[model samples]
Target: MNLETFLLKDKIQEIENGFKIKNGWLLICESTYDEIESKGIYCALIKNKYLEKYSSSHSWPINYGYEGKSNVYGDNSYQTYDNEEVEPFLFRKSFNIKDGIKKYIDVGEEFILFYRLFEEVADKQNRVYYFVNDYGELDEVIVVEPNKVKIKLKYLKEYITMRDMHFFISFEYMILRKTIDKDWNLEFIDKDFSNENYFYNHLIRNDMGTYQSWILGNYFIKPNVSKRSYLDFDNFHCEEFIIGIDENGEIILKNPKYESKGNFTFTYFKKEVLNKYYNNPIEYEIDSFSVSNKYFRLKIDNNLENIIPVLLTDLLILPENEQLHWKQYNIPITEDLKLSSTYYKTMILGNWYESPESIDLYFKHLYNDFNKKWYQKFGWNLYKPLAKEDEFNFKALHLITENNIKSFCEQTLTIVKLTIDRINEKEIVKGIELEPNTKGISKFQKFLESKNMDIPDLFEFLRHLQSLRSGLIAHTFSNSNKECKKALEYFNFNERNLIDIQKEIFKKSIRTFSTLETHLL
Candidate 1:
């Protein structure tokens, strides 16, 4: 039989039996150019009728001549077809129809059948075509072909699923495969499927509820398709059914999430997709980065040296309020020394002028005061001394006497003086040497000359005050009434004033040091 005869008979029989084809039907047959050409002729037969109906409904003049006299028609008769030609309706040229069939045939026989069924309903009331496989379930609707079939099928599937129906259908146009299965469903997979493992392991596995929560609350996916997934999860449903398995033993679905294992993890900083991306410890660049919380706990592998700098950089960027919580206690001061030695070394470097006994006393006072006043305020313990009581033996104290404090203070002061002279060359007031005329005295005299202020005499007086205080602290060994009163009086009378003056001096010193460091760098 001819193609037309076959289609007409089949459709006639279906309509006669009180069975109208639904909008979604699959045609699962191999077709050839000859078959498509035969179907094209059949498609043409009724194309004109749809065109006529469309034009008439839209009040467009028919392309063909009208029959009967003009006076026989009323004034409204021409108006009835006024806009028919302007309406957007399907109009296939003979060549385009032929070409479309040929293209369908190139996709192989099954696609040709789909094309044929698609054209048959192109102008018909019914928009569905069904393909039945005897080996599969009966009443099975394989694929639905329409211009908007994808969206339509999605809505249909959702409506059906909501009604608790077991069967659902989907179409694969690229491969021209039609599937009807009880278990098959739709799901959104990450675009970079290759690195899906990383996302799944790090993000999804820990909290599938997060995905559910996000979808339910935001009605959208987090790290949207345009960003991480590349697949829109909005209005997309997860298929509970596992269609089949691939050679690698992975489940494949009829409408599976299209993901490339290589494109799973997305790195914002790197601006690249990672296939085998992992959350393992690796160097990463961070700009203006900081954690919201105060205390940050880090887990490091056996090797820690490489990660410490990165961690420190992150801590430095934290706000002052936030930074106060980072208590750097129990940190190893040196790799090669005993803890006691490390503690003693830190104490000497941090507060050099204080004797070991004085260091212990100051730390105790500071710690108690901090715990009482600032611990809650700052959320950090700043007065953490390195040495424990057990490490502070009588022998250790004897070994580190007042001489150590005095020597360290003198050496540090000398270095500070040299640094000041080196930086303040332009500020020298010219030629005012002390009586000694030694290198140290000359340098001191030159420093006083450099400053364009009467503050030199004040500085000289403050130096004397510092020298006397140092003498009392070094020689007395005890904060006796005499030494204490002298020390207190000097600090109260001169030390406070000197400290205020030193603020501007320190500012200049810092600027000079920074400039020097920049040049060195």
Candidate 2:
């Protein structure tokens, strides 16, 4: 039996058997083309879509305005964006479907298009076909049929079958008003489906009680990452579903909020269908996020690196729930570092600036969203405890050893160096020469002294941190050395408090951000 009859019989049995027949439309997903033709159609559309975009790297020879005998001509002097000329008819003429398929001829001109799926991979599937187009240039047009389809329907099972078939062939889906003819055929009620609430209601199964919650609490959070970032949502469900035709001449729903991974006919609606479609968008909270993998860490923001190369170590965090599955070079899988609770604690209550306006002042003209990553990173990484392996082995791996501490110090000192460089570049402080053949802090201090400016206490704290690092870990010394005792006394830290000392340094580091941000500008 046809899909229409199969669905109609079930509906009739329900109504006749003393069941309440609800007034609703059955939106079915149906493919217009068979599998054999679909591959060709998909290829043609893909090629037409990206031909000019990849014109430079293509091996096709330039045959600009080449007229080889009859009907074989190329585009004259057409230069691509890369300034490379592309010849028309890169694809051979035998691939044209106009002669083989009659329906393709009805649509204006035939354009040969092809795309290699997974071209970079060893096993690539090539799809190519004649794309029908009346318009000179193809935009997102794939299928060459009536895309705005309106069907009369009122059955559930047929819809499920067609929906599953969408994995093999693309099709558009829409439910019109409940209408049927005398011969058990669904009748067309309207030209297009416009009831957004109705469509969302059925898909989301937002029954009478929870329907209002779905409508009122529907909000989308777009992350401040690149378009390719997984955290970035392409068609956040709040937006209307973008309907477009696939390579098959059928309507394919582009971006549905929910999808079925296994493309099979669902046996039960209430149990199978409802569970697959049900999702409470309101429960998606962005405020707090749990790491999706074993561990998560921060990376230095590369925002101003190309221009100034500032060493802002605590300036970016991995996206919430972003998984870090790969093992570090030396760290074994069994002893992988756990994300410290201190990371979360400081991130929640980080005091980076006196006010939000201070942030705006420093990050002026920078992307507004760029600061969000920095805010998360600075808060998380600031209070991270740094120590020798014997003292504290895991949490602060980047700053654990004497050499690593020296490297961290050097990296951290870039903030001061960056500030001075910016100051010199903008002529904020004129005629200042840092002390030669000295440590970074001494050089910075001499530069400040030459400018007749009192050194900030933040620098003094950094100097003490350096002293502690150099004395206890960086320099080779006997356990009872007098210099180690002197360094510990000067920094006001002893062997007992070595592990926790980083917390104080981090607090001091955060206090200086506003000052560095001011001078860097």
RMSD of each candidate relative to the true structure: 29.5, 25.6
Error of 2 at 37 (Å): 94
Question: For candidate 2, lDDT tens digit of each residue in 1-521?
Answer: 34343233343232222122122221111123332111110111112223333322212122212312133227554433222222222222223365662211111122211211111112112221221223221122212222111111111112213222110111212222222334644332222211211111112122343211111000011111222221112323221122322222222222222433332111100111111111211222110111112333322111211110101121113332221111000011111122223322333345232211112112321222333343454332211222343221111111112223453444333332222222222122235554446555655565556646564786666665555555655556466766556656665654434323433444454555555444432
**Residue lDDT tens for model 1, 54-83:** 222212222212211122245444443234
Cα shift from native, residue 242, model 1 (Å)? 42
Range of the 10 consecutive residues with the lowest summed lDDT in candidate 2? 212-221
Stretches off by above 4 angstroms in model 2 are: 1-430, 433-438, 450-452, 478-484, 518-521
RMSD of 1: 29.5
Q: Against the unseen true structure, what C-alpha lDDT does each candidate score?
A: 0.26, 0.27
Candidate 1 segments exceeding 4 Å error: 1-447, 450-453, 457-490, 493-521
lDDT of 1 at 118: 25
